[model samples]
Target: MQRIALLFLILGLNCIAAGAAEHSTACGSMQLAYYELGTLYYRHADGSYTGIDKDVVEEVAKRSGCKFDTVLESRVRIWTQLKNNTLDMSVSGIPTPEREKFAEFIPYFSTRNYILLHRDMPVHGLSMAGFLNDANLKVAVIKSFKHGPKFDEWLEKLWAQKRVYEASDIDSLLRLFLARRVDAIIALPTVWQPLLKKEEINKQVHLFDWAPQDSIVHGLIVSKERVSKARRDLLRKAIYSMADDGTLEQIFTRHMGSKLAQELRYDGPRF
Candidate 1:
């Protein structure tokens, strides 16, 4: 009798453990890392956070039964966390050849580079090649953004003849542009648009033609260390399902304006 009761207790314990694992296996418990940039991500006046990336992630988590923990950090720090295995996932990251080695990607978002200039400045028909080749142009870009290094390398190859000032964040860069401290600032349209709207700087700056060379496909980046193949496959399926069912489009349109959301959808996959 005693042996039978002990066996039953052990079986019950095993069943409980198995049940817990299965219940918690949903993606809802995953922690997602993202940067605090204007439309991409930001803290609201009420202390709640909202952004296009956050909206999409939330919907994905809901559909996947994953709980998300969003960490607010700089773009570079977000990458560092993912590389170090501290973060499970991140969004709006532009994949470079160098980054592909460390992280697995799910392509979904589209991004473009815009040349932000003082509304009063007389500049038009700018090109990346022309900007880099010029000896007298001064450009301001956010430090640690994906384009920074590419721009730096290009400038160095030109013997660092042009000035490339690095601003700490988007707001500072926009302020510098408005103050006429730099000839131009470069950033994604999604990031630049919100800041311009918030600061009422739209009338103060003129957006030049898109920089196709610098534009990139943004995607969700998963840490290779923390997630198993099964989990990764699940994530990919969820993303594709969202894309097909128009969940992705709905989230994009809800957070970003309809016009911009339409553009993002048309930009094609960024791999």
Candidate 2:
């Protein structure tokens, strides 16, 4: 009878394992949107995606026992599709009240934005207000990117003065900046480090932290319409678990160095 009981217990554990596997499979594959943002997510020569964001998503899927299908899209389009319920998930998203209505955000990382300028530009020590007042100096920015309220306000004023260039995406923005089409552009370290690795590009560009107090938390955003509440919570919990386990920091550290990784993980005054 004891042997029989042991056999029954073994069978019960096996059944539990099978049930968990089935549940994981039942979760289905989610559509994850990625964009070309520095070391966050980008395509490679082999036509594959790899970066800090990609690693985070992959690890979350592993912990949650879910699958994800990632596709490339611009930051603007990613938000639009999330609102339309056409996209299931995305990483590196900043949460706002409007976005929170259509999606649930899981905060994982923090970073600040800066004004990248040509090394030769005479805008050193100039505040954002001063930069704005210089009518001859034109600026470019990635469309639909939020660089804190002050930077956004400066952009608005620049726009009103017809001194702003709106690039559809990061690559185009970098090109415009590099080609000297725009006098300055706003970028985060994660978005510029990988793209500006070339010696010449590095020499041509410099950054001004217009708003030192402006830090923003970014993370996974799940569509409330397409993803069930339970599933969304599951993903969020997985990400939080990753943060607790130091997986998120390690991923960022692997892509960027330790200094920037620490800042991205716990910068002061997060927006």
Candidate 3:
């Protein structure tokens, strides 16, 4: 009986070792893309990156014991590369049908769409219909962003009437809005709040939530073509752990504040 028990213990230890090796081999190294979107990601003068997204990514890497080769890219290009499997991972991703076919999203935060208008713009009841009826109110949007279904519907209507301006990236969109080239821009409170820093600029901006009932979940995106099911499961577990342990809330609070952080804290079913 003693001999038999020893044999079982040795086998169990070997199985654990094998499992650890497999995990390491599966996610030992990966490619990650980052983009500038409000307080999510930004570059520093010393050629380093920081912000909520960066902090989250680093924490994930630490937990998973995976080394990430980070690259800077536009949101549009990030999606394209994710579809092509040329990228392994990216932050602040909201899944779509086409993207679901090529990537798996592990949600970490939640946000809703808001329309930031200049205070001097014509008062229009703060409704989509009011804004849509006013042909003079032109809005700018980032190229490949998903600002929720309602915003997309309004944007489509606006585009049909040539009342929309498209920007290549967030910085350009902010410039267009600040330069008075556009009447308003679609953004999340967490996104626009940090970008519009000047007190005078803040005074000129008025934010209205167009989709108060809708909350969009955003998080780490892993490419299906490049990542195996084993790795995806591992990553999902790591992200879920972060969400459960207050790590995610800590990161959000550090960058955006306790109130906004609590608002963004994701407490939904894991996908």
Name the top TM-score candidate.
Answer: 2
Model 3 agreement with the true structure over 1-271: per-residue lDDT tens digits: 9999999999999999998877666678889999887789876789777899989888887777677899888888888898887899999899888889999899999988888888887767367899899878889987777888778888999999999888997778889998999989988866777866768678888888788877888978999889888777878888899988999999999888898899898878876
Comparing 1 and 2 by lDDT, which wins?
A: 2
Which pairs, if any, clash in model 1? Answer: 27-66, 28-65, 28-66, 28-67, 29-67
Instruction: Name the Cα RMSD for model 3.
Output: 3.0
Off by over 4 Å in 2: 123-125, 266-271
Positional deviation of 90 in candidate 1, in angstroms? 1.6
| lDDT at 118, model 2 | 83
- The lDDT per prediction is 0.72, 0.83, 0.85
Per-residue alpha-carbon lDDT of model 1 for 136-172, expressed as tens digits? 6678888766653455465465435548778888878
Q: Please, what are the lDDT tens digits per residue for candidate 2 over residues 143-178?
A: 877888778777888888899889997879988988
Q: How do the candidates rank by lDDT, highest first? A: 3, 2, 1
Where does the lowest 10-residue lDDT sum fall in candidate 3?
119-128
Q: Candidate 2 — what's its lDDT?
A: 0.83
lDDT of 2 at 41: 80
Better of 1 and 3 by lDDT: 3
